[model samples]
Target chain A: MIELVYDVHHQVTFRWLIALYFYFTGMSAGSFVISTLAYGFGLEKFKPAGKVGVVMATLLLFIAPIMLLLQVGWPIRSVWNHFTYLNFSSPMTYGAFLLMMYPINCLIYGYFMFKGDMKRTKIFGMIGIPLAITVHGYTGFILAFGKARAFWNTALMPFLFLVSAIVSGLGMMIIILLIRDRFFTREKKINTELIYTLATMLGWMIVFDLALVFCDISVLSIAHAEAKEMTHLLLHGELSPLFLGIENLLGKVVPMVLVLTPKFRSITTITIASVLVVIGILFMRFVVVYGGQVLPIV
Target chain B: MAKTRYAFVIDLRRCIGCNSCSVACKSENSVHLGVWMSWVKVIQKGEFPNVSRSFLPLLCNNCEDPICVTVCPVNANRIEENGIISTDPHRCVACRYCMAACPYEVRYVHPIKKFVEKCNWCLHRVKVGLLPACVEACPAEARIFGDMNDPKSDVSKLLAKHPVQVIKPEIGTEPHVFYINLDNDAIEKKRKVDVL
Candidate 1:
C-alpha cells in the first residue's frame, strides 16, 4: 500500500571495524578467564593454558582498541579528547577506563605468574577477571545504551555479549593450545584430556549463549513495530545470509552441536568447532553492529 | 525573562513535496558532498490509479531528552541555552554513537571532515536573528520554526491550535519537531534500494 520513493537511506553507522574490535575483545576476555582458572580458582588441570591464555588475552586486548581508534575521525586527537572529555554516563566512557586498566592488570598477572609469584599472580589474576568482563561487557552496554536500535536496546545485550565472549575465548584457546602442543611443546603428542575439558566448558557456555540468543529473538519478534522488522530483516530478509545462515546455523548451532554431542566430540571435530566458533563470534558482532542501523529507523 | 526553547512545526497540508527545505538546509550547512542534514522522504501510497505522494520531511528533532547528548563519548553533544542539541565540532571524534542512537537517523558523518554532523535547525542563523534556511526557503511556509517559550512566536501559536505529532513519540525523546497530519506510512516503508 505504501511505497518509499525518496528517503535518505540510513547508513550502517557502526561497521565491521567495530565488529572486529568486539571480536578481539571478546576473545581477549574469554582467554583472561581461562588463564584465571588455575591461578585464581585453583583448577590445576588447566595450568598449562594459564600463561598462554594471559598472553593471548593481553595481546588481543591491545589489538582491540586500534579498531576503535581507526573508526574515529581524528585518531590522535580522540585519544587525548576521550581521556579529557569524560562523559561518565556514556557506555563508551566505561570502555576507556576498562581498556586501559584491564591490559595493565593482565601484564601484571602474567608477570607474577612467570616469576613464580603465585600469591601476587593470584591477586592480579582475580582483579583482571572483573576488568576483562567489563572491558568486553561495556561494548554490549554501548549497543544497549544506543536505546533506539530494536535488538541492541535489549537488557539481554550485556549478558549475550558476555557469554559469547566466553564462548569465542574458549574456542580460540583450544585452537591456540592445540597448535602450541603440536609444534611448540617438548612432546609431539596433543593434550586430549585438557582439550576435552576445555571443550566441555565451551559446550556449556555456547548452550547458555544459544539460550540468550533464543530469548532475545523471541522477545524482539513480538515487541514493537521496529522490533518486528528487525526480526524479519535478520531472520528472513537481507540480513538472513549473515544472521541465520552464518551467525546462528553455522556459527553457533553447528559449533554447539559439535562440541556438545558426545559421539561427535573429537580432536578434529573440536578443532573445527573451535574454528567455527571464533569465526561465528566475529559475525555475531558484525550482525549486531551492522544490523542495528542497516534497517532504517525513520 | 523566559529561556529560549526552539521548536519546529511542519504544516503537511501546505507542503507540496518540494525539495526547497532539503536544498536550503544542505547549502546553509555546506553539508559535505554525499551527506544530508535535512531531507524529505517521499512515499507513494495506494495502487497506480489511486496513488498519492506522501512526504515526510526529515531532520533532527533536537529532542528535549536528546539521546545523542546522553550517549556522546567525548561530551561533544550538548543542549544549548536555546534548547538546540548542538554538537561541539572540534570535540566530536566521529564516534557515530549518536548516529546509531538517534531514532530519527538524521545524523551523518561528514565525508571530508569526518565528524558526525546533523541539522541543528540552522543554529548559526537562528542565533543571528534569521530564520533557519529551510523555513525561509519554503514557498508555502510549511516549515515553521520559532521559540516555544515565547507565547507570541509562530510555533507557539500553531502548537496551541493544532494537534501536532512527532515521528516516534512513543520512544519518549519528546521531539521538539511537531508535524500536522503526519503520515505513519511515510515513516514505516523502506527505501527501495537500501545502500547499506
Candidate 2:
C-alpha cells in the first residue's frame, strides 16, 4: 500500500469563524426565502412564520457580516476593497454585494410587514426572493470555484448548500415559533398547521440534502484518487465519527424519521427533531468548510 | 517586445536540502515565526536499504493562470506586466481567499502586517538585477531563475536540455516552477499519519 503522508505546510488556512459566517449567511438566506414564499407566493399557511422569518433573517444578516469581518486580517481594508476594488470574476465579490443588498431589502420588507402594508411587503418579497437565493448560493459558489480543494470542487455544491440552507431555516423557524408560543404568546396557541407544514418541508429538504451529499461522495470517490482518499477520510478516517455519527445519524436519519412518522410528529418531537437538524446542518457546514481543507493538494 | 515570463528551474539531483534557502527567505523578508513564504518539503520513500529522500522546495509557482488572482474578491492579487503574480499589501484585506485558491498552498496571512503574503520571486531583487535570496543562499546552486521568454536565459536553456515537471500539472495552473529529475513519489498527495 502506498501511504500518502499529510504535509504540515498544507494546514487549513480558514477556521471556525469562516464556517460560522457561512452558516449565518445561509440561515439568513433560507429565512428570507421562507418569508418570500408566504408573502409573494400567497402561501397563507406560511403567513405566521413570514414576518418572523424576515425579522430573523435581518438579525442573522447583521451577525453574519460581523463573523466574516472578524476573520479578516484588515477589516477596514476589506470593507474599502470590497466596494472599490471588486473583481467581476470572483463569486465572493458578488457575495459581498449580495449580502449588502439582501439585508437592506429584508429590513424594508420587515418594515412593510410590521406596518401591515401587504401590497408593499409583497413587492419587496418578490425582489428579496432572488436576492436571498443568490446570497446563500454564492457562498456555495465561493467554495465550488476554489478548484484547489478536491472535496469542494463540484457543481452539486451550490444546490446542496441551497437545500441545507432551507432545512436549517425551517428548523430555526419552528424553534422560534415554539419559543414564541410558550413564552411570549401565552394567550394564543401556536399554529399546528404551520408547524406541520415546516416539519414536512424540513423533512423533504433533508432528503434532498442527503441525496446530494450521496451523489457528491459517490462521484468523487470513483474518479480521482486524491478525491477518493479525501472521501475515505470523511467516511472512515478521523472525521468518521463527526461525519457519520453527528452529521449523518443524528442530523439526518433520526430527525428525518421523527418528522416523517405520523405518530412522532407531535410538536415536542418535531421541536427535538428540528434542533437536531439544525445541529446536523452546522456539522455539515463544518465538514464542507473545514474538512475540504484538511487534505493538502500537493 | 514580448513581456518577460519569469520561471524557476530546480535541479533535485543537486539539492542537499540543508534548508539554507528557507532561512535566507525568513531573514530576507523578515517573515514571522511559525509562518513561512518558502520552505523545503522532504519526502522519503522505499524500505531500509532502498530508502531514498527527496527535498521539494515549496514556494509560489507564479502560475501562468494563477487561481489566487482569479479568486481574490478584491483586486489585491494581480499579474504584473512581467507575468509575476503579486499581492499588494495596501490593497489586500487579508481575507486569505488567495491562500485557499492556490493549489500549491503557498500563501499566508502575515501575523503583523495583516496582509496575505507569498514569494513574488523577490521582485525587489529582480528589479535591482540580483537573484532571489533563496537562489543566492543555495550552496549547491540547485535553483536557476530567469526569463523563459528570453531564448538566451538560463531557464529557457535548461528547459530545452532537461525533462522538467511541474507540481500538480493535472490541476492545470500552468506553474512556472519546474522540477528536473524529481521522484514521482515526492509529488503524490500525502496521507496524514496522525491527527490532533
CA error at residue A171 for candidate 1, angstroms: 0.4
User: Any runs in candidate 2 off by more than 4 Å, and if so which?
Assistant: A1-11, B193-196
TM-score of chain A of each: 0.97, 0.96
TM-score of 2: 0.96
Q: Number of the top candidate by DockQ? A: 1
Evaluated at residue A188, the lDDT of candidate 2 is 65
Q: What is the TM-score of chain A in candidate 2?
A: 0.96
Global local distance difference test of model 2: 0.86
The local distance difference test score of each candidate is: 0.89, 0.86
Please provide, for model 1 over A1-298, each residue's C-alpha lDDT reduced to its tens digit, 9 standing for 90 to 100: 7776876655568878898999999999999999999999999999999999999999998898999999888889888888999998898877888888999999999999999999999999889889989998899999998877887999899999999999999999999999999999888789899999999999889889989999999999999988888898889898999988998888888988998899998999999999999888888998898787766677
Interface RMSD, in order shown: 2.0, 3.0
